[model samples]
Every structure is written in structure tokens, then in C-alpha cells.
Target: MTTPVLNTVLVRCSHTYQDELTVGDTKLLLDTTFRPEWHRKISAEVVAVPRKLNTRHTAYRGLKLGEIKAGDTIYFHYFGLTKENRLDTEDQDLYAIPYHEIFCKVREGVISALNGWALVEPVEVKSGSAWIGTDSEKISTQEGILRFIGHPKTDQPALNVQAGDRVVFSKNADFINTIEDKDYFIMQQEDLLATQPQKANEIESDYAGPRHYYETSPFYLSPDHD
Candidate 1:
């Protein structure tokens, strides 16, 4: 029962492993133990959290603090957690995660991106000919559809785009996050361009020689703004 200091959260991580490896042939074979992948962002159980600055608690009932709770399942970058912030225990290892470092929360098998991050599926643009022997080609559009968005923050206004909206963005924003088995881009609110209609926009242009890339921008009144 440790009440984390400040807005930090104390969590116990869940371990994932790959199957054992067998080396050598027949009689001289050796079986290697399961290898742990601690390098990736892993899920963890919230042990405790301090709701206030430099606060402590003897016991927390539901362990609920703001949107975080004691027993809630959340994701964090374990390999990225600094060595000074980790603690070891006989039962399970514990980590002190900054309130903003919480990747997302897992609730009833559904994941909601947190800390102003939004989950998106990149739209696949392709070209193909109807000819029987022709092969299809994939183009990098740098565009995606908005999926689940994180909770609203007090300091930021609501984003212009919502779930199911098509948006254009730059190459890669942040590290890719995988949920279940599907990979989604964890994008910040500022990286998103204005939402476009579901139907593709075919803007006319004179430079039509293999336009494989796409770019987006927000409207601004200031000309000097870069």
C-alpha cells in the first residue's frame, strides 16, 4: 500500500514472453528458457496514485483518483522508464510513472488513448489496372482515419476531428502502438490537419508525374508564420 508522490502512479507490470528456443540437432539439443521482451511498452496494473501534489494516503477504497485508479489496467513505456524511478519487490516490480506518461487505460477490453494521444489507422492508397496480369501498387498518402481519441484535458479545447474522420498528416508522428494485434499510430492533437470528407478529394494540379506523397497544413492569417 504505497501512495505515490505527486501525480505519479505506482504500477506493477505484466510480463510477456516468447517461446523457448531449441538449439543443436537431435541428441545434442539444448532448450532455452522463455525470453522476456521487456523492451516494449507493456501493460500494468495500477497499484496506487497520489491525487495531489506531494500527497500520501493510508488506504484508498476504490483507489480511484481522477481518471486513474488503483486497480485499473494501463500501458506504459517500461524500457523508457528511468532507472531511478523503478522499485523492486519480492511479489512484483513496481514503477513510478509520471501522470502524463500513462499511454492509455484498458477498460473492459477496450483501450482509450490518453494524454492527448489519438489512435489512427493509416489509409492505404493503391493503384491497379484492370488488366489480368497487372500488379497493384501501394502509395504512401500520409493520411489516416481517426479512431479512438483520448480524454479531454482542462487546458486544451476539443479537437476539430472525431472518430471516423479522415485526416492528412505528415510521415510518422510518434512511436507506433499495437493493441490486440492491430497497429495504430499514436498521434498528438497538434499533428492532425483539418478533417476532410470521407470521399477522396481530387484537387487538380499540373505536376501529375507520380505524386506519391501527401502533405497537410492548417490555415493561418499571418503570412510570416512558418
Candidate 2:
């Protein structure tokens, strides 16, 4: 008698019984969480492809199996499929990284830098200084990098930086703080404030305007005249 050939396929899946998972356990937990939804949208044959980490993936709004593809690998603790503020955290409802870091392998997918801080390019300071005087006061046009103090809506407490204050850019200190051949806004050392540790709970409102949950806040007209 002839024996029949058997086809063996290893399907990957994972999930959590608890609220959060240790980073070390994530890989082992993946295969168990794989669901029918994984191949509902895309052909099931594509799941065999190997995926790299720290890259982008297709982000869907819900857990609909019909929307996912075979090659797609889910990176838990990241952005939600379609929702604006939902992310992979203890509180799925709480807002985190607004920009989604999509997997580059997936078609029609875009990726984000996934950085917390924004870049403030160099600005031109008048006469290599920020201050002049009333009659002789020099004006600075849009020439230098403006440090991203904070979001106007989320920072309600008010943190202020004057024209002549120096700030150390977290990402690029030497390039940002020093003067180059081109005119830039390098505040004199005397005018700069020493860096102070900000409390996590404390919102930076001075530079940015006010702190309000973007989804819940109402629209308001500009109170100040131009």
C-alpha cells in the first residue's frame, strides 16, 4: 500500500491574559495571537514571509479579519488601525504617538520617524544678537529653527522662552547651539536659562499656549489682534 504525503504548515499567533507584557515575552507570544482575521483581507499564503522589527506595518481601525493580509505582522503596543489616539499601552483609550509608524514592507503604508521631539531649525538673529532696543531694535524674520516647546493645546501651564534665551537642543546640541557661517539665533550665554528638570505631571504651558485634550476641546477664536 502507498502512503499519502502530509502537508505541515506552522501558523503564528499570540495574545495576553494580563494587562501588559515584558518586552522579552513578546516574540514567544506572537504565534498564539494569530487569528483568522490575519488572512481575511490578504491571501493566507503570504503569511510565510519573514518580517523585520522596528519597521512599519499596516494599521487598521478594528480587529476585522477581512482587512488584514497574510504577510502582515502585528507590533503590539504601537498605534491603532484607524483610531486617532489609541496605542499599545495599559490604557488603550489614552492618546500617545499621533503619527503611525507603518511597516515599510506593506503596500500603501507610510512610516514615521517615531521620535518624541521635533526639530527647531536655525533662525537669523540681528547682529548676531536677539536684543537691540526700541528705536534700534532688530527684528528677526523666519530664519532660524524654533525649538518645539510643546503643543499649544496640551501645554496649559505656560513655559516661556524669550528672544535672547539659549536652549540646548536634545538631538543636536553642537550644531544647534553654535553660530555658523549663516546668520542664526544663538542666544548669548548670559540670557539663557539653565536647564531644569520638568516634572512628568507638570504641563509646559508657557511657550506652547494651553493644555487641553485635543479630541474633547472646543474650537476658539484668536483673542489677540494681529
Candidate 3:
């Protein structure tokens, strides 16, 4: 006899896909994956926030950090567009699946914007360099191109960069042999999940010149006289 697993949340499947699925769908996916009988309990809430513009296709907007407190209960599903090619005996056609499956929480909701974060900076290449794109399109120089790194976005899949992989950027810089490629930019830094240091003390650049010490101070009176 299959022992009935006890759970307080009930999840249902929804045919339609929405940024925020119904609460019912949330419970169903949880039941299948997060075996409540054997795993520790985890929960959170879904709160909406401003969406970032020009993000990846799968990256939806309106998700904020701290949407759910540490112990609040919540459920979710994957929401986005997908493409699939298939050849079959019954029918020959491509199957594009826009699916939403329920998912239960086994840990804290730490992936929210408030809890989750990112840092973006222009790519850096020297004034002159030679490089090639994963597409084999040779970049001769760096001019109208920008390179950066952060949480993997849906855009620019050719980057093939991982959490620690170096991100390189290149554009069509030449039309002849030994294309005249210039270094545009590079986000050679590691994953920026937290605050980024604008200036480091060890290596000082002109960009980090000493301040006048009055950027935020008003005219000061003489020390001897008020």
C-alpha cells in the first residue's frame, strides 16, 4: 500500500501560462518533487517588482527580492517561451512548448531581486587586439561594441560564459585580412551578486584621483575665527 504523504498545500495545474500562476498550481508541483515526508520544510511568498528592460526571453519582470519572508509559504513554475523540432509517424511538425509546471519550495526564497542582485559594466579591450566570436565572425576592432558579464541572460547565448567564465565582446572591425580589431570592453570580473566596489585602494587610476574633500562639505570658517 502506498502511504499517503501529508501536506498542507494543494497544487493544481493550469493550462494557461501567466507571470504569476494561480496558487493551486503552485502546490501540485511541490508535491511531486519536494517529498515533504522526507525533506525539511521551506516556504516563501511571491511578490512582484519592476521588470528589467531588454532581458532574456525566459527572464520575466515584476519579481522583487524579499517577496516572501524567511518562513512564508509559496509555490511557483517556470514561465517562458520554447521551441522544439520533431519528426513523427502520425504527423511531422515542430512542437513548441510554452509550459508551466508547479514547483514547491524546499528552501528560502533567496532568488528574488531584493535578495538576488547583479552588476553590469562595459566590456574592456585594449585600443588594439585580435579576437574571434563563437560564431567565427572575426572582430577586427572595438568601437561600436560593448562587452560585460553578470547573471547569464537569455540574450547573447554565443557568449557560452559560466559563473566564472570570462566574457569577451567583439564586433565586425575590419573587412580585409588581419581585421583591425580594437579592444572595446570586457566584464572580466567575477559574478557580482552583491555590491561592487567603485574604487579599489590597491591600484589607483586617474578615475580614482584624490577628492578635494569638499564634494559634500560647505564653505568652512577659519579655525581661529568663527
Ranking by lDDT: 1, 2, 3
Local distance difference test, candidate 3:
0.24
Per-model lDDT: 0.56, 0.25, 0.24
Candidate 3 lDDT by residue in tens digits, 54-173: 223333322222232223333332221111212132322212111111122223422221112221222223223542232223333322122223333222222333332222323321
Clash counts per candidate, in order, are: 0, 35, 17
Q: Given candidate 1, what's the lDDT at residue 158?
A: 72
Summarize candidate 1's per-residue lDDT along 1-226 as a digit string, tens digits.
Answer: 6677676788775543222222333232222232223234456778897756422432221122477677888775545344566776654467787665565787777777775667766444333432121012333345567787875554466787788887776555634555554556666666776777775433212212221111122432223344
Poorly placed runs, candidate 2 (over 4 Å): 1-113, 127-144, 147-167, 170-226
What does candidate 2 score on TM? 0.17
* Two-way TM-score contest, 2 vs 3, winner: 3
At residue 212, give the lDDT of candidate 2.
Answer: 22
Instruction: Tell me the RMSD of model 2 versus the true structure.
Output: 20.9
Evaluated at residue 130, the lDDT of candidate 1 is 24
The TM-scores of all predictions, comma-separated, are: 0.63, 0.17, 0.18
Task: Tell me the deviation in Å of residue 197 in model 3.
Answer: 22
87-150: candidate 2 lDDT, tens digit per residue: 3444343222212221111223421111122223342233333422211124222222333332
